[model samples]
Target chain A: MNQIDIGKWSQRDLNMLRTSSDTREIDLLTTSVRDLNATLQAFGSNTRSDEASFRVLTPNGAHAIAVGIDAPLNVEIAGHVGYYCGGMNKCASIIIDGNAGQGVGENMMSGVIHVKGDASQCAGATAHGGLLLIEGNASARCGISMKGIDIVVKGGIGHLSGFMGQTGRLVAFGDAGEALGDSIYEARIYVRGKVESLGADCIEKELRDEHRAELFALLKQADEAHKADVSEFRRYGSARKLYNFHIDNAGAY
Target chain B: MCGIAGLFIKRTRLQPRLGELLASMTSTLCSRGPDSAGFALYTAGEPGRAKLTLTSVEERADFEALGEMLSRAVSAPVSVVGRYTHAVVTVPADLVNLCRNWLLENAQDVRILSEGGHLEIYKEVGYPDDIARSFGIASLGGTHGIAHTRMATESAVTATGAHPFSTGPDQCLVHNGSLSNHASVRRELGRDGIVPQTENDTEVAAGYLTRELKRGRSLGEALKSSVEDLDGFFTFVVGTKNGFGVLRDPIACKPAVMAETDDYVAFASEYRSLTPLPGIKSAKLFEPKPATPYFWEH
Candidate 1:
């Protein structure tokens, strides 16, 4: 573990680091959240920055660690983080070395957030656009109400994942808990393992060549291209029965 | 936004450090819950004695006199020790309910926290850090323990509303997330004569478990029944005299993580709370699945 004295680095220093093409390290235990957030805000405000990298140590379950960052820098958090670790992220490539609490990449417009360990509930909740990848299992509501994001989970996901999704793709390599993809719309789901139960309006469909290609590409991006066969996945999507007004389905509704 | 933590020592060597480890784990979740904090410690008890924990609205109360009165009424010795706004009363094991009934009829200002041969509960409405320090929990020793920090979603912030709710002898429960069907369940349990002291949904859950256990169901079986009957989002960690358990609701929206090593089995609302545990770096870590109940006995 690299020990860093947070007092040695200032927010101004962080801005300069963003402009410079070098890697930096910051210890969360040694610094206050105000300073760390100030540094992240400064890094976000400046556009057209160099390819800088930051290594954060001892996150220790703090919430909103790298929220609302618009930069394309590489950020790595060394320990477990609390809620909203990469919330509202844009263009940044954030990585968590350990497990993440709730809403790891919630509402991200554009970016890549990778968790090397397990993620809590609502990992990518309500995200519009981004690529969220989890190497380990994710708890409930993994991609609820997703608009345009593409999520890839290598392990099992808990209940209520991909609920009310408007548009996007969710690919899971392991089992799904109860009520997966409830009341979904447009978004497609691909699961390689057992699905405990399907949600309302969600039905399994045949895997076509186009879906296989897409899954393969997603796996390559998530760095798991050679791990499994893409043809093993089953597809799930909305049945479109709930989209129109029908008096026959009134009692069901 | 509540925090729940539990520690069960599997190795005999780590038994003495249970309180120190649990205090650190519970204190890590201070930011998650700032309204109240409480813990239930399972210490060594005398063969024929039970401990009754009580909390008053204020720090000043006639706990000594209450103990004397209880001793006289039960025809047994009763000893009292005051800690902050709470007190522990030790009496004969079989007369626990007698003393508890006496308190309920006489001492209206004091609330019974727990009554068991091996369990002692302490709780207060304050910052979690302050409550832990005031109780001097770190220096205490035990075989196992559980704690909670409450954000108070359903009820007001009171010591009675704090978690580690003990509904049965040597049994306690702490919870995260709200129960959507708690109002109906509370009514149902009340009809069964398992009334709860506070309006907190967690207390209702505890009452349900106590009722199930009273009906000759095992801890694991009661938890499994909870998965079928309980509605809403919740991650519950229950502690008994000789066992520990964890259960998540079907939806499982709430967060829960468990870590186990040769030395101990630990649980927390988040993984950060498990960092201070011994050998956690190499411990077997996993998130409990939804609707799956897990139990550990010693």
Candidate 2:
């Protein structure tokens, strides 16, 4: 497949290319959300095509861009995106040039999503496995109900983040908001700054050598290992004592 | 789910473009809400007069005659202007309640959308863009405005059921989540004489704010108090005569993003609705904290 130069193509040319089944490498600028979604849907269904890559221009905070991508490909969105970008992603590497709205990389199985700016609430909610990187802050519930996904936020995270988190690792380089990690499970959380309050069943733990090593490796994967020293971060997880029913803790429940 | 957009212009130069900018912001959230849409625009109003925006199934039912009847009853001159299925009635400020009561008795089918010195609300059952176009929103100018596109959860889809529900003079609210204890709260507000028009949780929430503000509580204070009384997941963007405010529940399960520039302060249910604003790429962006009322006034 030849490299397609999106800089020279008009919006109409991009639209025509999206409709053509033979085009493997496409560059799209100024396309409507419906058309772009249609092109991505085609890519998800067409298994016979060779490796395909796409470059999106002027996203203008459109929602649901690059969703349901199951193929192993590359896509770059040049501007900010709205909710559910890279949702249900699989075997892809998606990059965003600007801030993201809610649920970016939501419910993903396997992928690498890079956000150049901050992310809204539930940034990587309910994802199974992937690497979600945010260069800036993430709002409330950043990793709510995650199954197994590694997330790294270079800035602060908001309240109730990592709520009911079952598994995976969440690393924050800045302060965490109130009620962080409410009702959390086996997920490991590493924070570099102060926590306003801890939620029920979530308690601070010692950052042992093993935890430090895991956080260091995760930060390296996010390409932000040098931002903060792994030893400076604190670890948090479930208390585990609440998992079993006890008569003495019935009042607390 | 519902979508909300708000624009507060700090610069007078941008006031003329408020509706156009607001329309674009509201239209970007079409995917969030395709059931119905509405907006409350704040513009200049004559002193000593109050405006009431009402929607009627019958658009051409001689609103002028109804206005004459209201004028005679209130001992003031009243004028009504019809736009599409909505009518704006201007009357003496002291007689606004009398006009509302008279409408309840005389025009049972007509519902007051908003009553304020500067607010004129337009709402309908349709997509956000189509509702904006049908109401000529692009041509309307304002100092600030708020729009809502709703996917109904608690109530049926109707013009009156749409959001930007105004319960007090120059006050409107748009919500993006459902209330868990609305029935009980509705009963509580009913005892306080703040009867809502519908069973929709948002209306109950609006009535709660109005009741608080009527008790002399400030907008920020009312929203702050909502955290304790209003139980549910919610992201609320409220507009007053001279202010714009945003609040989220303690949990903040819903999504809300805000951006501020020298010219304007914008709020959207998601960042996509706010991206089209001027100087947005360089604007100061932040998510409002849970259980905190962030407000800015002119």
Candidate 3:
């Protein structure tokens, strides 16, 4: 119902607008996190940050637009987001024009969240539904307790990603964090990257033909530089012991 | 509409704020259904039957009048067992058969959402917290219960659309899936004197399953009948007087998980939902194979 332009507004005025879905149609290029936060607040459920249609725009000097909406909003944040960007979405579709921050797309359900940017730590720590795409790098705790969501980080993730997942899929582009899928329950993790270290109960498994096909489909759709070849990556999953509670695997840490 | 959560406190006395846990699950899922909420809990030898929610009457007085008529029509004594936006009736065990008959006849106007021994429900157009406060579902202390979190993509977000719908006496079902053959199935079931309360395929499945179970078929057989007979991608969890049950269409398009241990058991469309159940950290969780029906008999 309102349009508060960040480009013209003073810095003090920017913080007042916490979230958005208005006038997201107008492209005001600035890289300040305060302005971008205003942009996140202005754009509500119907629009996107930088949705499906791609364009090259580098907004310099931005930190974060954390706590995005819970609707079908999309975004292509040029360059990278600092931290916790695109968090808590419902039916939005966002693709980072560049790399992303740590904990990207946290607690999102029912949308497609992509990060062409290298993600920081704990990417997708506790998401519900939707597909998360990380093109370059991803930090630790990716897809932890991820319920019905799928994450494909093209690069590598930090330690302790996916510590306690319920139901969903986590696909890594390169390598994964340590203690991945520890105490996991019902969620599936697929990685095309190397296994620097396995989580508590995580183990490398065969990348079946079905997995190859799925990776191919995602790569073809996601705008990553390595869209063509996914043969180098391997798959990791639970040993099925974590499916049930065990005294031997007592330490979920 | 709103959220619903039921837990049967078996091993020991229920937590003092057991209702709070259910309220949390329902309220957390408030975005799914934001209209109304209700809950019921029955203890041993209460001799009280629960009427799960089915529909929102155009007029409350008219719905009450219908309740009276249904009691006489089915030769049972019916009462507004649980008050909410929808219908939740409680009858004596002797009158359950008559109540079922009444529910069948009145299915056109209302749905017998869920009627059983342990739990009762009806919800719409709100979050779970509002419903729990109004219906006092948080207070029900039973051995087990089932709740619904709805998005209403396929079904209208109405009281009739509230979940834990009835399929048979002492049987209520919660589902998360789309039924492609809803119209055809409705037509087929209509020929057999079963009237569904809504256009939602979930209610139709409930009606069909109710008919099958009342006709002396076991729940497993009735559920197995659904694999091929029920079309489309779906996964459902049905709760009855005897135990907990899980079912899916020929393909398990919807997500579901079951966790069991010597002390307790839990299942949800997503694994995170199970976190609130008692003894969760100590539980063992497993996913059901596609189209396979899993049952935990008490």
- Most lDDT-accurate candidate: 1
Off by over 4 Å in 1: A1-21, A44-50, A250-253, B57-60, B180-184
Query: What digit string (tens of lDDT, one per residue) describes model 2 on residues B1-298?
Result: 7899999999999999999999999988887899999989998899999999988766556777788888888788998987777889998898888889999898887889899999999999998899999888888888999999999988899888999899999999999999999999999999999999877899999999999999999999999999999998899999999999999888777778889999999998877788779999899988888888999999
TM-score of 2: 0.88
Q: Write the per-residue lDDT of candidate 1 for residues A16-122, one digit (tens) a residue.
A: 32434576888987987668766876874465546567888888778889888877767889878888998998877788988889999999877788899988889
What's the best-to-worst order under lDDT?
1, 2, 3
Off by over 4 Å in 3: A1-253, B1-12, B15-19, B35-56, B61-82, B86-92, B96-112, B116-119, B214-217, B249-251
Better of 1 and 3 by lDDT: 1
TM-scores for candidates 1 onward, in order: 0.90, 0.88, 0.51
Write out fnat for all predictions, comma-separated. 0.59, 0.88, 0.00
Point out the worst 10-residue segment of candidate 2 chain B by lDDT. B56-65
The CAPRI-style docking tier of model 3 reads incorrect
* Candidate 3 positional error at A153, Å: 15
* B1-298: candidate 3 lDDT, tens digit per residue: 2223334444545534445556655555555455433443333435555454445455343557767777778666677643655555666766776666766666555655555665555455566666667666666555666667666667677666667676555677777777888889899888988877677788888887877887788888888888878887777777677667778664344545556766556665443455566666556645455566777766
DockQ of each: 0.50, 0.59, 0.03
